[model samples]
Target: MLSQITPCLWFDGQADEAAKFYTSLFKDGKVTRTQYYGEAGKEIHGQEPGSVLTVEFELNGQNFVAMNGGPLFKFNEAISFQIECEDQEELNHYWQKLSDGGDPAKQQCGWLGDKYGVSWQVVPKVLGGMLSDPDTAKSQRAFTALMGMKKIDIAALKTAYEG
Candidate 1:
């Protein structure tokens, strides 16, 4: 069955490359199919005939399409995929992998922009609860700790929450 909603990512010319890279990172990911550009839209797109047009892939069970849509659009921080990490290890692993070739300047509050310019938030699942705790002091401490870091340190967050 097809997913009711799928995210389509736009790339300048790295649709296939990005798809492969992304799928490699997740255990539940795979490149299911790929499509190429034909001469039909030559005048508008100007891409070489038979070049990659789109790659349909699944990441962590969610279907996504990567399209070589030219430089007309770029990914921004306004929209980001948040990875709710189960623990510090999971959070560290993802943060390291995703931010390897990413711009260092974009790191803030567990949010990072990957090499493809796509924004992602690698946060521990406990973060939400800490931030929403009924005790204002605990929540505020957690918020302060969160605001001070780029990639999250689960220990520090917990300490702040327990304070």
Candidate 2:
């Protein structure tokens, strides 16, 4: 059997809603399967008789599972999905969708709550190369530029580090 480890997002009785919202965000992905409480051959769950058990879905080629696992755990900024965009337009599209229930941090980056309190980062790939330059001078310049802004500006970072 093929096996893969996917991020299992825990939601407080809103797994279905979160799954639907996430499926709507990305064009390349869709909801694959969903298991509810009273479905065929389903295990018995307490309190909520016919609640959602798990939601299996994909977003931008990544697989994720959402569970109506009550309020045992919560999402924080400590973990986030980094979306590498080629340009501003792509970034804007992702940013707008991900930021639906989020509060903007500043510049181009922000912390999105998703419908499930999950956070994701919309970043530019160019920012990685600029920040990881072998030359300390270039790296420093990139860091300086990145520190001043919330949403990363790839063009400005390249100009500062390359020049």
Candidate 3:
């Protein structure tokens, strides 16, 4: 069974491509189904009858749908997908893959905008613990260090926390 809520990504006639790219990023990712526009809505949708309309995919076990909804809307940083990695290697891998051809100006504090304008936060699992340490000073230090980084560095955060 799937969850009650699923994220729907809007794209300008790139649903299929986006789905393939996203599925390729995670181990458990796959495209479950693809739907196409029909002649009945030709006037309303303005898309070819056989053209792809939506693609349902899973990324790291999370259900998502990419829709070829035309160019009426665009993606913004208001929403983002956060990938919590187990270690530095895992974090770096995801960060590099997702940020390829992305906007360099938007890369800050582990947040980046992918080529498709989708924002992603590639962070390590340890970040949560460091930022939430019981000791206020340690947590503050970690937070300060985090704000200064583009990609998260687990080692730096640990050093800040221990300080």
Candidate number of the best lDDT: 1
Q: Write down the TM-score of every candidate.
A: 0.96, 0.84, 0.96
* TM-score ranking of the models: 3, 1, 2
Clashes of each: 0, 3, 0
The lDDT for every candidate, in the order shown, is 0.95, 0.76, 0.92
Residue 75 of model 3 has an lDDT of 93
At residue 99, what lDDT does model 1 achieve? 98
Could you give candidate 2's per-residue lDDT for residues 67-87 as a string of tens digits? 987777888877877788889
| After superposition, candidate 2 runs with Cα above 4 Å error | 1-3, 39-47, 105-115
Model 3, residue 159: what's the lDDT? 91
Q: Tens digits of per-residue lDDT for model 3 on 1-163? A: 8547899999999999989998888989999999999998789889999999999999887899999999999999999999999999999989998899899888998999998999999998888888888999999999999999999998987898889
Clashing pairs in 3: none
Question: How much lDDT does candidate 2 score?
Answer: 0.76
The runs of at least 3 residues in candidate 1 whose Cα sits more than 4 Å from the true structure, single-residue gaps closed, are 1-3
